[model samples]
Structures are given as structure tokens and as C-alpha cells.
Target: MKQETHTVKKEFIALMAILMSLVALTIDAMLPALSQIGTSLQVADSNDSQLIITSVFLGMAMGLIFYGPLSDAYGRKKIIYLGIGIFILGNLLSIFSNSFPVMLAGRVLQGFGVASCRVVSLAMIRDQFAGPQMGKVMSLIMMFFIMVPALAPSVGQGILLFSHWRAIFVLVLVFGLICFFWLHFRQAETLVPEKRIPLSLASLKAGAAETLKHPVSRSYMLASGITFGAFLGYLSSAQQILQHQYQLGELFSLYFGALALAIGLSSFANSRLVMHFDMAKLCHWALIVITVTALAFYCYVEVLAEQPSLTALMAYLAVTFFSVGILFGNLNTLALHPLGHIAGIATSVISSVQTFISVLIGGIIGQLYDASVVPLVLGFFFCSLSTLILIYRTRKTSAI
Candidate 1:
């Protein structure tokens, strides 16, 4: 019985992580191909290429609100199936895209489609776990999810070695199809008929109100957006910074993978430590680490008045992102802890708001790259500082 329960838990975590990875893979795997795709499509500016990344996020923000409510009303499995279908369609659109706008449109649709995977997975997790255990489970899920980013760029680069950039979409489409079948066959519907909320405007409004009205949820939700924006800034500019600026060229994936490994390790650590510490405290200290690291790096870079050595930049990023890994799971749990009854709507509103805010901030940061790490470091510092302010506000509330 014990082994059976453990096997079941492992399978559940793997599925959830893979579901989330569909989003990460779609985003990260495109990094290597951004330049190729941009040039192939005759983009006017190299910076504009980052739009390919942020556009998906924008679509996710637009689609997130609908998925949560729909999943709440319908059921988790059906919504997931629907999402995968849309994702497949998006990939096909991208595979056949002849222009930049068409590619962006396809990417947006891909994001919109996969938005179900993200929100529904979280909703299902909330259906099963709450409080610190939820945080632990999230950390465990992230442990696996982080591996996608670690390897996606390299996989993407490898694909480029033998095929056109469009082939990446074909790969993603195949992966999406496999996930769809896996969910259909292996995963049970977590939100049962009796527990499902009837889909209605009034119910959605109440759910949104309940989610935002809670002090911890509102504060952490904003904090998550701000912090994630910092991460997204790196994502958007990573190709330019690593390939063009540092001239790592073909070796860019290895460095990106190292930083991803740092984050993954921290997530694993958090999963163990959550049992011994408060989730809120973990997030607070993690933000403190990120804020301090970014601030010190910004100062160092400004004093040098040029791009810092690759080693210094890597050191700083590793520390900041490792801390970021700790914060991700904990902050999510803190935000949704009190909203389990409305997890579907709460996850939707929070995910939508955060993704929208992050995409805007990340888009600006990407545009500000300027062939130096200064903009990226500054973006990180400000975002972490902003999140620290919000986290402090949450502390003032007894609900925390």
C-alpha cells in the first residue's frame, strides 16, 4: 500500500511537471531559433525578435482567466484535452508561417492553448494539497519542470543543426500530442461533478473578488508577477546577451543550462526545507537574496562602465536565480493558500494578472538590452525591490 501510494504520487508529480513543461519548452526551445526565425522572416530589428517570446506570454495572460473558470465548471481532464488541441493547432500554424506577424499570431495561439495546462494543473494540485504541503508539492513539480529549460535550448540548437526553425514547432506539436494522450489515459479528473462550480459571470466575479480581497493572495500575486518579470527579462534577452554580446555563439545553451541547473537544485532544496520552515519566511529571504545580489551586480557593472566579464555575470545570475527558485513555489502557495475553495478562479485571475504584468515588464527589459547586462541587472534589482515591498505588506496582514 505504501509503495503504491508513493508510485501514484510520483506519477502525479511527473504529469503535473510535464504539463507545466509544455509551456517552458515552448518558450525556452524557441530561444535558439529566435535569431534564425527573425532573419528568415525579415524582421526589421533584432530586438523585435524578443516579441516572439513575449507574445506567447501575452496570449497566456489573455487566456488564463477563461481556462480556470471553464475547468471549474467542466472538469480538469476535458479542459486539458481542449488546451492540447489548441496547442497542436498553434504549432501547425507556426510550422506553416510565412511572415513575422503570422509567426507571432501562431505563438500567441500556442500560449493561449497551453494556458490550460498551467492553470488546470495548479487547480488540480490545489484540489489535492494545501498550505505548506502544497508548497512542497509545487517545489517537487518545479524540480522536474526546471529540467525542460535546462535542456530545451540545447535541444533546440541540435534541431537547428539538421533542420529549419519550423522543425522546432513540429517537435513541440509531437510532444503536445503525446502529453494529450498521457493525460487522457493516466490522469484522473480531480474536480468531480459535485465539487465543480457552475460556470457563470456572477460566480466568476465572486471568485475574483474572493481571490483579490484576501491580503496574502493579492500581495503575493503581485509579487510573483514582479519577480517573474525579472526572470522573463532574462529569458527575452538571453540569446542576444549570450550570443551577440558575449559571443558564446554555439555554446550559449551550455551556460543557459548551468543557470537553469542552479534553479532546479534550489527547488529540490526548497521541497525538503519547506517541512522545517515557514513558506512565507522562505520567500522573504529568497527575495532578499535576489534583491541584494542584483543591486550589488548593478553597482559593479556601473562602476566598470562596460559589460562585466562573463564569469561575473554568470556568478550573479546563478545566485539570483537560485533564490528565485526558492521563492516560486512558496510565493505561489502563500497566494493561493486561502483560496482553495475557488482554486480554479483564483489560479486563473492570479496567473492572468501576473503573466500580463510580467510580459509588459519583460518586453520593456528585452528592448533595453543595449548590448550590455546593465539593463537586465537593473530590471532584476527593481523587480526584486518591488516584490520585497509587497511581501512586507503581506506581513502586516494577520491573514499571512
Candidate 2:
């Protein structure tokens, strides 16, 4: 019985991660197109281009909050379908867009739909796994999830080589169909009737309270939010920072790939490492390593007053993201650790809040983009510092 249950659980994790990768591709593939978008739409400011990236992040972030409790109430399969449908519609609309605002509108739609895949998939996983086992599964899930996002720019660049820019959405549509059918047929229901959470205000209050009531869960949630915000900030600015600021246009895909490869490699490493270390201690140590790296990058930008090479920027940012791979999966497992019973709701709200706050902060940071690396460096530096304080205080407050 246990072995059968475990098999079912692994299948769920595999299918759900693939579902969320559609959203990943939507966001990551747009990196090479950031410059094209600004020029085609005749937008006067490069910073405004960030709205394209942030719109989806912001939309998904908000969508995630509601998706959690709702999925708990409705069951994962239905919500997953609903979310995919919405994402496909958005992708279709984006394919028709010729203006920046209209394109952003499409991105927003895509984001909302993607949230269903992301938040619901997470809720489903948390329904079955926890601790080191959870981390191991999520790490593998992330490895697949990371591939589409990491290679999106490369894919986009390649598509652009032989086709119109909007052709990317066609791919989005194709993947959406695959994911929708895969879930519709192959994936079994993970959330049982007893697990259904009603979407009442009382439910929200109760769910939020339940998650927050636990010291470990609360710290992990808040820390994950801040740590994730740093990634969002990176996502928001990476394209513009790399292409426009660094004058690395055609090479954008290669650079994006390298950065993504760093994340993928580190994630696989993290899965193995977690077996040897406690989740919190590992996350805490990863935080220290990233903070020091960000600070060093910030110092280099400030004192050097010279434009860092593409090699240098990618290297430093890669270090920051490598820590992200280490921190994200474990932190998520930590947040869901004690909430096994309410894993669905916990996954939703935790993801929603973490992403919502991160996207907002990241969008703001991206808007600070100049023709330099200072803004990106400073953003990561401050983000790391804030997350450090939040985690430390949680530890202190818990002691009290």
C-alpha cells in the first residue's frame, strides 16, 4: 500500500511540474524579445518594458493566493484545467498584440492562468510529501521546471531566427494543449473530499492563521517570500540589463542559458545535499553565502565605476541564483513541513504571498534599471539583507 501510494505521489509531482513549466516558458522566453518589444511598440522608455515581465509575475502571484484555498475546496484537477484554459487564452491574445500595453495585457492574462498550474501543482505536492523526501521530489520537479524557463530565451532566439516574434505563443499554445490533456487524462485526484477547503473568509482567516500560527512555517513562508523577491527582481531586469545595458543582443540566449544552467546544476546538488543537512540550517547557510556574494558584487560596481563584462555579471548573478535553487525548494518544504493536513491551503497562500510581494518588489527594482549593473547589484544586496533579518528575527521571536 505504501509503495503504491508513493508511486501515485511521484506521478503527480511529475505531471504537475510539467504543467507549471508552460508558465515558465512564457516568462523566460520573452527575455530576448524585451528589446524587440520596446522598439516595435515605440515605447519611449526601456524601464516600461519591464511591465511585460512583471505583469505575468504579478498576475500569477495574485492568482496563487486564491488558487490555494479554492483548489482545496474544488479539487486539484478542476482548478488545474481552469488555470490552463485561462493561460491558453492569454497566450492566444498575446500572439495578436502589436502594442506594449496590449502585450502586457496579454502577459497578465497568461500569468493568471499560469498561477493555477503553479499554485495548484504545489498544493497537490504538499498534499503528499514533507521534509527531506519533499525536498528531494521538489528538487527533481524543479529540475524539469527549470529547463523550460532556463532554455526559453534560447528557444525564443532560435524561433526568431526563422519566424516572426509572436510565433513563440504558438509554442505556448501547443504546450498548453499537451499539459491540459496530460492532466485531464493521466493525473489522478490528489486532494480527497475530506481535504476540501471551502473558500470562505472564515476559511481564509483560518487557513492564514493556521499557517502563521506555526513558528517554523511562518519563518519559512516569510523568508521564502523575500528570497524569492530577489529572483523576481533578477527576472524583471535580466533581459534589459543584459541586452540593452551590456550590448549583448544576439548572445542574450547564451547568457540566459548560462544563468539558468547555474540554477539547474545547483538545484540537483541541493537535492543531494539536503540529505546530509537540516533544511533550515542549509537554507540559513545558503543565505549567508548569497548575501556575501551580493555585497561583494555591489562593492565591485560601486568602487569599480566601470561596466562589468558580460562574463563577470553573469558569473555574479549566477552565484546569486545558485543560492536561489538551494534556498527555494527547501524553504518551501519547510513552510509546508508542519502543515501536512492543510498542505493545499498552505501551498497556495505561501506561494501567493511570497510571489505577490516578490513581484511587486522586483518590478520596482527592475524599474530602477539604468544603463548599468548597479541597480541589479544593489537590489539583490538589499533583498538578501532584508531576508536575513526576517529569518533571524523569526528565530529570535520563536525563542521568546
Candidate 3:
């Protein structure tokens, strides 16, 4: 029984990781194609191309607000299938789009649909695990999830070399189809009928209110928003910064992949280490590390007015991303820790709030890109500092 259980758990983690990776694959794979899509669509401002990324986030933020409660009322599996269908539709729409507005709309739709996979998967995991154990599983899941980003840009670039940018969407659609069928055949409905909540507006409002009333969860959610905003800023600007600023061109994917590998390695390490440390403490320290690193990088570029060599930039990014990897699983586990009973609605509300806030901060930072790394680094510094402050305040309040 123990051996069987262990095998089952491993399979579950892998499936969940693939589900989550769909989001990363969707976003990161589009990075290398942004300029091509922009040119083909005749975007007025070059910076506006970043909208291709943020639009999905916006749609996701909106879609997540509802998927949680609906999933809670229905069941995790059905909502997931529904989300997959919507995601496929969005991909098809994007593939057929000839204008920027249509493409943006399709991206938003894709994001909105993908929210089900993200929210439901987190909820499903929370259903089966909790505490440091939950952190361990999430770390393992993220270990696989991070691999998507590590290779997605390279995959996108390779596709662009041989085919039109639309091929990327086709790839996403094919990937989603595989996930859907695998999920259908292999995964069982984790939410029991007796445990399911009723689908109602009042219930959703109450759930949201309950989620907000928890000081720890609320604080962690806000911190997550701020931290993710910094990450999003990096994602939105990374292609331009690498290709234009460093003149890496096609080599941009290699550099981006290297940074992504740092995050994957750190997540793998965190999976092994989380069992020995408190998730909150790990997150607190990781935030501090990122804060200091970001501040140093900002100073190097701003006050010192020195352009860091490619080696120095990559080193700084690797450290920051490693800390970020540690924070991702831990912070999420912390936010969802207190609300496990209402995991579906809780995950939705928490994720939606965090994503919404992140989109605002991240969109502004991305738009502020001035062919320099100053805004990106400064965004990271301030966001991490704010997150650290929130963690401190939450800890103090919790002790009382």
C-alpha cells in the first residue's frame, strides 16, 4: 500500500505540474514571437507589444475571480475540462487573427480559460495535502513547471525559424489537447460531492469575505502580488532587453533559458529542503535576499551609471531568480494554508487578487521600459521590499 501510494503521489505531482506548465508555455513561448507579431500587426508603439503578455494576465485575473467559486460548487474536474475548451478556442482565435486588437482579445480569452487549470490544480493539491507537506509537493510540482519557461523561448524561436508565428499557437493548442486527454483518463475528481459548496453569488461573496478576513492569508496574498509584479515586469521586458539592449538576437532564448534553469534548480533544491524549514521563514528570508540583490543591481545601473557586463547581469539575475523560486512555492503555501477547508474558493480569491494587483504593477513597469534595465531592477527592489514589510507585519500580528 505504501509503495502504491508513493507511485500515485508521484503521478499526481507530474500531472499537476504539466497542468501548471500550460500557463508558462503559453506565455514564455510567445516571448520570441512578440516582435514578429508586432511587426505583422503594425503596432504603433514598440512598447505596446508587451500588451500581448499583460492582456492574458488581465483576462486571467478576471476569469480566476469566478472559476474558484464555480469549481467549488461544481467539481474540480468539470471546471478543468471547461477551462481547457475555452483555452483551445482562444488559441484557435489567435491563430486566425490578422490585427493586434483581435490577437489581444484572443490572448485575453486564452488567459481567462487557462485560469481554470491554475486555480483548480492548486485547489486540488490543497485538497490532498497541507502544511509543509503541501509545500513539498508544490515545490516538486514547480520543479517541473519551471522547466517550461527554461525551454519555451527556445521552442518558440525554433518554430519561428521554420514557420509563421501562428505555429506557436498551434503548438499550444496541441499541448492543451494532450493535457486534456491525459487528465480525463488518469485523474479522478478529488472534491467529493458531500464537500462541494453550492454555486451562488452570496456564497462567493461570503467566501471572498472570509478569505479577506484572515490576516495571514491576506498579507501573504498581497506580498505574492507585489513579488509576482516584479517577476512579470521582467517577463514582459526580457525579450526586448536581451535582443535590443544586449544585441543577442536569436541568442536571447539561450540567455533566458539559462536564467530559467536557475529558478528550476532552486525549486528542486527547495523541494528537498522545505521539509526541514517553516515555509513562512523560508519565504521571509528569500524575500530579503531578492530585495538586497535587486537594490544592489539598481544601484549598479543607476547611481554608479555603469552598464554591467553580460556576465555580471546574468549572475545578478541568477541569484534573484533562485530566491524567486524559493519564494514561489512557500508564499503560495502560506497564503493557502489557513483556508484549506474552502480551498477552491480560497485559491480563486487569493490568486485573482494577487494576479490583478500584479498586472497593474507589472504593466506599469513594463510600459516604463526605456531601453534600460533601471526600471526592471527598481521594480524588483521596491516590490521585494514591500513584500518583506508585509511579511514582517503579518508575523508580528500572528504572534499576538
User: Per-residue lDDT for 1-400 in model 1, tens only?
Assistant: 9999899999999999999999999999999988999999999899999999999999899889999999999999999899889888888999999999999999999999999999999999999998778888999999999999999999999999999999889889998988998888988899989999999999999999999888778889999999999899999999999988999988999999999999999999999999898777788899888889888998898889877999999999999999999988888888888899999999999999989989989989999988888889999989998898789777877444
Clashing pairs in 3: none
TM per model?
A: 0.99, 0.93, 0.98
Q: What TM-score would candidate 3 get against the native?
A: 0.98
Off by over 4 Å in 1: none
> Candidate 2 at residue 14, lDDT?
76
lDDT of 2 by residue, 1-400 (tens): 9999889777776786788788788888888877777788898987887888889987787678777777888898898888888888888888998787888888988898889888888777777776788898888888777888778899989988898778878987898889999898888788888768777889788888898778778777878887777788778888777776787888878887888888788888888987887767777778888889988987887787788777788788888888888887888887787788877678877888788778877877778777777877777778778877777766665421
TM-score of 1: 0.99
TM-score winner between 1 and 2, please give it.
1
Highest-scoring model, TM-score: 1
Q: Which candidate would rank higher by lDDT, 1 or 2?
A: 1
A best-first ranking of the candidates according to their TM-score comes to 1, 3, 2
